[model samples]
Target: MKIHLTSVLVDDQAAALHFYTEVLGFLKKHDVPLGEQDRWLTVVSPEEPGGTELLLEPARHPAARTYRDALVEDGIPLAQFTVDDVAAEYERLSALGVRFTQKPLETGPVTTAVLDDTCGNLIQIASRPR
Candidate 1:
């Protein structure tokens, strides 16, 4: 089976959607009410419209709290996104006022950078030699 969806835990779904779409240039595909204030929101790559969905999940749950806290405490990265040009993407997002934890730097075969999502998640942007 193909991987159709992957979830990212966020403190606020709306804020995550804004960051993913408005800031990162992703496109929103589905956003339906899940009940109360909860929503089943998703984003897709602009280049691959229906390829995969990034589930914007709330981190208020006990399991999510534990998992996110553990990662933050250990200073470990939470997720990585590959880009064609990390430096350019980094600059573009920086201009949009995104907070970056680390500047872009060469790491062996890959050049990478890191940023905070403001929702207890560290996002990594990387590019490898072609």
Candidate 2:
């Protein structure tokens, strides 16, 4: 079996799209209008054009808001993305004015950092040990 699609609840799909693509370097894959000011928007990593897609789902549901709020309140990342080098990525992103909650820290065989997504979520960027 293979993974297909996953999602991150976003307060604003448009803003999320801009951040994920223009900033994080993901490519837009699908964008079908779903009515009521919402769309089925998704993005895929440039390195893996046909790989799993990340859906920028709207957090309009009551339960979704509650869950997202709790996660943010606890300083938890809404999603994680693998990078070639955590420190380099962090430096680049920081230079772009991205706010990070956690700086790159080595934990055993992996290094990770958390940054604000600017659309109501904290996202983690990590690098696995070589």
Each prediction's whole-model lDDT (CA)? 0.87, 0.93
User: Which stretch of 10 consecutive residues in model 1 shows the poorest summed lDDT?
Assistant: 71-80
- Which 10 residues in a row give candidate 2 its minimum summed lDDT? 64-73
Off by over 4 Å in 2: none
Model 2, C-alpha of 84: deviation from truth (Å): 0.6
User: What TM-score does model 1 achieve against the real structure?
Assistant: 0.91
Candidate with maximal TM-score: 2
RMSD per candidate (Å) reads 1.5, 0.9
- Model 1 per-residue lDDT tens digits across residues 1-130: 8999998899999899989998988899999999899899999989899798988987777888888888776656687888999999999989988888788989888999888887788888899676
* lDDT of predicted model 2: 0.93
Model 1: number of backbone collisions: 0
What is the Cα-based TM-score of model 2?
Answer: 0.96
